[model samples]
Target: MAEEDAASKRRRLGQEVPSGGGVGEDGGDPDLIGRLPDEVLGSIITLLPTTDGARTQILSRRWRPLWRAAPLNLEADFGSLTLLESERVASQLCKLLSAHEAPVRRFSLKCNGRYGLSQPIAPLLQSHRLQDIQEFELYVRGDLPPSLLSLSPAALRVLHICSRPESPLWTTSTLSFPSLRELTLVDVDVSESALHGVLSRCPVLETLLLDNIRARRVRINSLTLRSVGVSDCGYPWEARLEELMIVDAPLLERLIPRVPSHHLVIRVIHAPRLRTLGYLHDDIPRLQLGTMHFEKMVLVRPSDGMRSVKILGLLSAPNLDFVTGLLKCFPCVEKLHIVSYTQMIFKNDVKCYAPLECLDRHLKKVQIINYEEKRADVNFIKFFVLNARVLESMKFVVCRDKCGAKWIARQHKKLQVNGRASQRAKFDFEADCSRGPSSMVDMKHIHDLAMDPFDRSSCRCHGDALH
Candidate 1:
C-alpha cells in the first residue's frame, strides 16, 4: 500500500517513480525544486494569479502551507468568460478571499460585459483585506464603488480605472491619492471640478494617461508630473480632446498625443523642462509652444522658438514644404520621425531646403514608418541621405509584403546610399508583419513612452498589417 502511495506522489509531480523507489533506478537527480525553502516558494506563489496560486496547494503537502502564507495577487479577468461564468468566478473569488490568510498585494479585475457591474464586485473590493493593496486596476461597465476611491491612499502607488458607462465613475465630490505615482483613466466621464480634484490631489503623480475619456476643456497644472498622454477625449457626441492647456508643469518631459481620428488644439503656457512632444498632424487647428504659434501646422506668429524640444513626431502625407517649415520652428531637434501615408509628387528640391539647423548639426537619427517605396517616398529618402550631415542611422519600417532583399537593394540604389552625405549613417530595413495597423503613437500608458517613444525597433514592427 505504501509503495503505491509513493508512485502516486511521483505521478502527481510529473516524475516517474521506478518500482525500486531509488534515485539510481531512473539515473536522474532528486526533486531539486521541491527542496527549496518555504520562504522562496511562498514568494513565487504571490506572483501568480489568485486561482492559480490557490490551486498550487494541491500540488503536494509541502506546497499546501506555502500558498496560505504568501501575499495574494488577485486577478479576476472575465474578458473571455461568459456572463454566467464571470458571475460564478466572482463568487468563487469572494470565497477564496474569505479563506485567504495573507493580505492582497495587487488587484486587477476586468470584465467585458455590462453584467460585470451587476456582479458583487463592490463587496469584494470593499473587504478589509484589500485596504493595503499597492496596485489597483478595475475595468467594468458601470459606476465604481465609493470605497474604491477611499482605498488606503498612502499604500496605493498605481491606480487604473476604466468605466464603460456614459456617466462619470467618480460620483463623490472629493477624490484624493497623495502617494500615487501613475494614474490611467479611460472612457470615464469627468467634470471640470472632478478633474481638478483628481489632479490636484495626486501631488506625487509622475505619469498620467487619459484615453477616450469624456471631460470639458482639459487644463494640466502639476509640479512633479514627468509624462502626460491624452488621446480622443471630449464629450460623448464629439469624442476628441477639444483643447488642452499645459498651464504649468515644471518637471514635465514627454507629451504624447494620439489624434488619428479627431482634431485637437494644444497650448503650452509654461513647461521649461519639456523635451519630447508629438504626433502633431495637420488636423490640429492650432498649437502654441510658448511664443510660437501654428495654425494647421503653418507658422503664424513667431518669437524665440521652443529649443527645449529634442524629439519631434509628425504624422501626415509626405509634404516637404510643410515639414521644412515645422523643422525651422524646432531648430535643435536631434531625432526627426515622420509617419506618412499619402504619396505626392516631389516638387521641391532638397538643395532648396539646405542649411536647416537640425540636418546640419543636431539631427542624428531618423525613422520613416510605413515606407511603401513609392516614387515620392524614394525621393523623400534621398533627401535625408544626401543631407543630415551628422546623421548616424536611418531606419525604414516597410510593410511585410513590400520587403525583400531585391527590393531593399533597389531602394539603396534609388536612395543613392553610396553618395550619402553622412559617412557613418547605417541604414536598417525592417519588415512589419503585425496583424493590426501600425500606429505612430504605440503606447498603452504615458510611462510606456520611454525616452525615445518614436523608436519602433523595440516593438514588433507591424509596419502595414491589413486587418
Candidate 2:
C-alpha cells in the first residue's frame, strides 16, 4: 500500500510541529528561534494578540522579518474601541508606521471618549525616523487639534500637555519648543501672551512648575532661572525673582516698592546673600527689615529694623509692647526662641515687656516654648533671672494643663523656702508631651556660676551656694 502511504506522511508532519520545539519532531521551535534577540525577537513579535501583533510571520522561520525591523509602539485603545474601530486602528498603525524604516522610539495614545480632533497627528509629528522622541504623553480630554500645536521641533525631551479647563484647546497661541528641557502646565487657562509664549520659547529651560495657572499679567525676567514655583496665581505678579515662592497671592499687598499690608514681605536691601527669613502668614501688612545680613531671623509681626542678627525666632507677637519694640532691632542677638500663641493673650493686656528686660545686653540662650503659668510667664522668667548678663540657659516650657502641677510643685516649694537665693536658681523641670500641656524647665544660671545647675558637683554640699 506504498508502505501505508509513508505512515500517513509521518503523521501529518507530527501535527505541524509547534509544542515548544519547532522542527525537531518537525513542528517549530529551533530552541525558540535561538532564543530571540533582534530587539528581543522584535519584542516577542510585538506582543502578539492582534492574532499575534499582526501574525508574527507564522511564528518561526525565525519570526520571519522580525516584525519588519521592529521599533514601533503604536498604541490606540480609544477606550473600548470603535470610533470606527479607532479610525481603523489609526489607519492601520499609520500604514505600518509609514512602511517603517527602523526608528519610532515610543508613541502612545489613549484618547478617552470624544476622540475627534482632526485625527492626523501628522504621522507621528512628521516622522523622518523620529530623532529621539523620549516621551510625549497627550491625554486629550477634548479639543486639541489645531494640528496638535504644530509639534516638530523634533528631539522633544519631555512634554506633558493635559488639556480641559473648558477646552477650546485652552485658547492656543503659537507655543513653540526648540529643544525643550522640561515644562508642565496643569489646569490651564493660560494667557499673558500664553505665559510669555512659553517663557520665550524654552531656551534650554531648567525647571518651571505653575499650578492652577491663570495669568493675566506676569513678566518674569529670567537670567536662566534656577527654581521658580508660583502657586494659585490669579494675577498681580511682577517678578525679578532669584528664588521667590509666593503662595496664595490673594491680591498680594506688596513685596517690591514696599507695600507692607502684610501676608509675607521680605525686602533685603544690600542683601549680603541673605540666609533665611521665613514667615507663614495669616495677616501681614508691614514686615520690612532692610539693610539685612542674616544667619537666622524669623519674625511674625512687630515690624523691626533688624541689623546683623545671629539667631532670633519670635512667633505669635501678641504685641508684648510690640515685642519690646522688636527687640530694639537685634543689636547682635546670640540665641532667642520665644513662641507663644493662643491668639496672643489679652485679658486686659496682661503684661509683656521683659524680653529679658529688653534685650539685656545681647542675651544668650532663652527658650520659652508655650510656658503658660502666666504672671506674664513668671514675669518672663523673672526677667531672665534678673537681667541676662550672659545667661547661658533658661528653657521654661510648661504649656498649660490649666497650669497647676500642684501650682508648679508649690512654686518649687516656694523657691526652696523663699531665701537661699531661691535655692541658688539654676532650674530644670521637664514633662513635655511634645509641646501641648507642657512642662520643660531648664536654667543653667548665666555668667558661669561655675556652670550652675544650682552649682551641683554631686550637689556641692546641696544648695544655697551663690556667694
Best by lDDT: 1
> lDDT tens digits, residues 15-108, model 2?
4333333233343324556544577667765544333454777756755676667655555546556567766766677676678655554555
Give all candidates' CA lDDT scores: 0.75, 0.46
lDDT of candidate 1 over 115-220, digit per residue (tens): 5544455667667778778888888666555556666546788888887765566544566777888888878877766777778888899988877776657888
Clashes of each: 2, 12
**Best-matching candidate per TM-score:** 1
Prediction RMSDs, each to the true structure: 6.4, 23.6
Question: Each candidate's TM vs. the true structure?
Answer: 0.84, 0.22
TM-score, predicted candidate 2 vs. hidden true structure: 0.22
**Regions more than 4 Å wrong, model 2:** 1-82, 89-91, 105-132, 135-139, 142-156, 165-180, 188-205, 211-467
